[model samples]
Target: MTELLYLFDDSTECTASVLSCLPTGDGLYAVTLDRTIFHPQGGGQPSDIGTINNVSVVKVVHTPEAVLHLTDHEVAGEVVLKVNSEKRFLHSRLHSAGHIIGLVGDQLSWHATRGNHFPGEARVIFEPQDPASVKLVDCVQFQAQVNQIVTQAFARVLTENNGIRTVTWGNLPAYPCGGTHVKTLNEIGQVEIKKIKLKKGQITVSYALT
Candidate 1:
């Protein structure tokens, strides 16, 4: 397993040793690092795209064995891995915003089943529950509620224990996750609750950044 540097450190650039570089044809190679700062596509987030020693890293994926970085060149030796800061910041915002929505869902007794933090498609899916026992909130009220939750400073807590990683925001519930996130709730800025809908016993909270 590759040492995931992004978990503990949010730095965009790091130096890594190229473990193996296998050609995947069309002048592309699948490179694996001894450790990496790149976040693989998983946990409702997309892969981090950047450059490895000037070689373009188009995509990153987590195999059962290691994190494979698809690059345009066959690299070797120690090289610098530079994660795209613009895309990373956007992804962090999307992910943190989604988690905040999940936090609100928990307050409403609507635990999140899953979430997608991709840009323009960010939404939280809640488990199906008894409608009679549920209290619904409208989009406007939901946004207000989110504002109430996020306006205060909420320091992010990322912890790893026994190979398991969890993230928490202030007094909110800690969630098992592996994706990247904002360092603080204030970094998430204004969250826009696009819509809140409950249908067929399931609930969906659609959100975006303002």
Candidate 2:
């Protein structure tokens, strides 16, 4: 297994040794490294795109055995692994925004059932205690509350026990997650709750960064 450098370091670039490089069809190669800063596509966040020795890394995936970097060209020996910083920053901001929205949902007595932090498709789905009680006005109020918290720029606290990582901000409920996030809520910038929709028993709150 590859050591995930991003877990411990904030830097988006790192030097690593190529452990194995194998062909996986379609003119692509599955490259493994001793350590990597590239975040694999998981937990609803997309993979980081950057270069390995100037070779484009098309995709990244985590397996039980190792973290694979899919590239168009083969690479070996020592390589400089770099992530597209712009994309990384956007992903972090959007993911942190989702968490804040989840906190707001808790305050409304709604339970978060799912979330997607992908840029342009970010949303949090919740199951309200009383589905009929949810309304657009309530969503607007919730958005205001979330923006207030973001303005406060609460620090994000991360802790792990028994291999389960929990993230918390101020008095908000701690949530178990493996995705990347900003160090503080203020980095999420202006959060706009685009819309709210009720489908069956699920209340979906769509959001965007302004």
Candidate 3:
């Protein structure tokens, strides 16, 4: 099994020396490294896309023993894996945004029935029994307040206790998650809520960063 560097330390970025690489049966290159920072797609989030020695990494897939990097070309020599910083950053931001919506909405007694970070567009669907109590305007206002919390640049703490990785959003929300996230709430910035619908004891809240 490969040691997941990102799990222990999400801040680490590079691995200086890499060992042998092999093509696994699942159409993915099993690149063994002394260390890595790539966060594989798991826990309801998509994988990271970048390059290994300048060759584009098409996708990062999870395996029982190792995280595979499916690259654009067959790699050789002492390989170097580079995760797309922009994509990683954006995904991180969006993931935390989803968590914020989940935490705050839960605090307000609005339970999230389904929540997802859909690459470019992330959303959290809530289920509130009395839909009339929370208006669309209320969602907008709630988003405004979320941005305020984001602006504070709160610190992030990651921990694994009892076999579950927890992503803690500052001081408010502490929940188990395996997805990548920004180190601070300020990175989330201003967000927009949309697609408010009330049906069958549910209130859906969709989100986008503005």
Candidate 4:
């Protein structure tokens, strides 16, 4: 298994030894490293695009076996990896904001089923404990609740055991996650609840970063 460097911290660049390199397509290659700072396109977050040994990386795929870095050119031996810091920061902020929304749902006795943290398409899907809670999907009130959670200085805590990583926000609920995130809730900034919809006994809370 490739060492997941981003799971421990948010540093953007790292040097990793290339374990294997193979040609995947026309003038493209899939390179696997001993460790990776690139967060693959999974868990509702987009893949990290950057450079590996100066060759442009088009995609990063997280597979059941290892992380593959798709590059414009071939690379071997020890390689320098650099991720787009701005894009990564935005993705992390969006992801962390989704977690806060999940927390809000939990407080309302709703269980979060899924979430998407991609920019311009961020939202959380929840299964309400009571049908009455479905009526609480107010843009104004829900925004206030989310704002209240955001204003708090909650530190992001990560723990791993037996290869499973768990994330926590201060004394809030802990969740199993494999996605990238900010170090603290403060980095998420302001979250605007765009719309809330209830349909087929499920609630969808759409949001955006301001």
Candidate 5:
């Protein structure tokens, strides 16, 4: 099994070190590693972009057990892979921000259905149960409180309960989430709810970082 570096009990950069590389096909290779902090394209978040052995990784796809990094060209030696920390941090911030908004909606008696992360130009969409319950004024109030919570520098505690990853936002919202998140809410910084939609008794709230 592959060891996830991010799963470790430490605060460090989200990167990984290559352990061994073996040819898999004519133009493809399977690179194994000791540990990796790269949060692969899972939980609706996109995979990271960066270099591996000086060759740019075109894509990273997550599987059941390992995240495979695919490069444009084949390599022949020990390689160094550096994750785009900017992208990683952006995703982390947006993800946690989404969690905060989602939790707030739930507190308002609005049942959230699903959430997704749009990286680079980060965005989070939340499907609420009662469309009539969502209001522009309350949305503004929710965002203000969310920002305040982020400013508190709350830590994200991940725990395995019943074979699932639990992502707890601060001490307020603790739920099962398999996605990656920033260590603290303060790292998420400021967030804004750009728009909201209503249809079929369902409210959709969209958010962005400013």
Candidate 6:
């Protein structure tokens, strides 16, 4: 099993021993390391791209067995691992913003059904207990409330129980998650609600970072 270094601390770079380097078809190689600071693609967040022994990492994926680092070239022995700091910061901001949006949905009596934190496509889908109860005007109010909460700059906290990780912000409701996040909500910058759509029994809120 590969040790996920990012879960414990926010180290941007580390040197890890290469366990195996296998060709996964095409010209790509799947490199496995003893440990990694890379955050694999999961939990609605995209994989982190960086370098492994100077070879560019195209993607990172977590399997039941281990974490696989996809690279264009092969690597061996002790490799220097580094995560792209800019991409990591953007991803963390987008992901943490999504969680804040989820909390807002809870305040509206809606449960978050799904979410996407991919840069330009970031959004959260909520399922209201009663779809008819929400109105178009309510969406505007929701956006205002979320922005007020963001301005509060609540500190993001994380804890683990029985191997399950949970994320909570200030007095907001806590939720299970395994994604990277900023230390505080203010780091998320300004959140703009791009659009809101309510259909069937679901409400989709699309947002962007300013």
**What tens-digit string does per-residue lDDT give for candidate 4 at 9-113?**
687888999999999977789899999999999888889899998899999998888899999888999989999999999998898889889888888778889
The parts of candidate 2 lying over 4 Å away from their true place are: 129-137
**lDDT of residue 185 for candidate 3:** 83
TM-score of each: 0.93, 0.92, 0.82, 0.93, 0.78, 0.94
Q: Whole-model lDDT, candidate 6?
A: 0.87
- TM-score for candidate 3, please give it: 0.82
lDDT by residue (tens digit), candidate 2, 100-182: 89888878778788888899999999997677676433667988998988887678788888978788776667888877788
Which candidate leads the pack in lDDT?
1
Q: What is the lDDT of residue 134 in candidate 5?
A: 57
Q: CA lDDT of each candidate? A: 0.88, 0.86, 0.73, 0.87, 0.67, 0.87
lDDT (C-alpha) at residue 158 in model 5: 83
| RMSD in order of candidates | 1.6, 1.9, 3.3, 1.6, 3.6, 1.5
Output the better candidate (4/6) by TM-score: 6
- Candidate 6 per-residue C-alpha lDDT over 142-163 given as tens digits, one digit per residue, 9 for 90 to 100: 7788788777778888888998
Which residue pairs clash in candidate 2? none
Best by TM-score: 6
What is the number of backbone collisions in each predicted candidate, taken in the order shown? 0, 0, 0, 0, 0, 0
User: Where does candidate 3 clash, by residue pair?
Assistant: none
Q: Model 6 misses residue 131 by how many Å?
A: 5.5
lDDT score for residue 56 of model 3:
73
Query: How many residue pairs of model 5 clash at the backbone?
Result: 0
- State how far residue 181 of model 4 sits from its true place (Å): 1.4
lDDT score at residue 66, model 1, on the 0-100 scale: 89
lDDT of 3: 0.73
Candidate 6 residue-wise lDDT at 125: 91
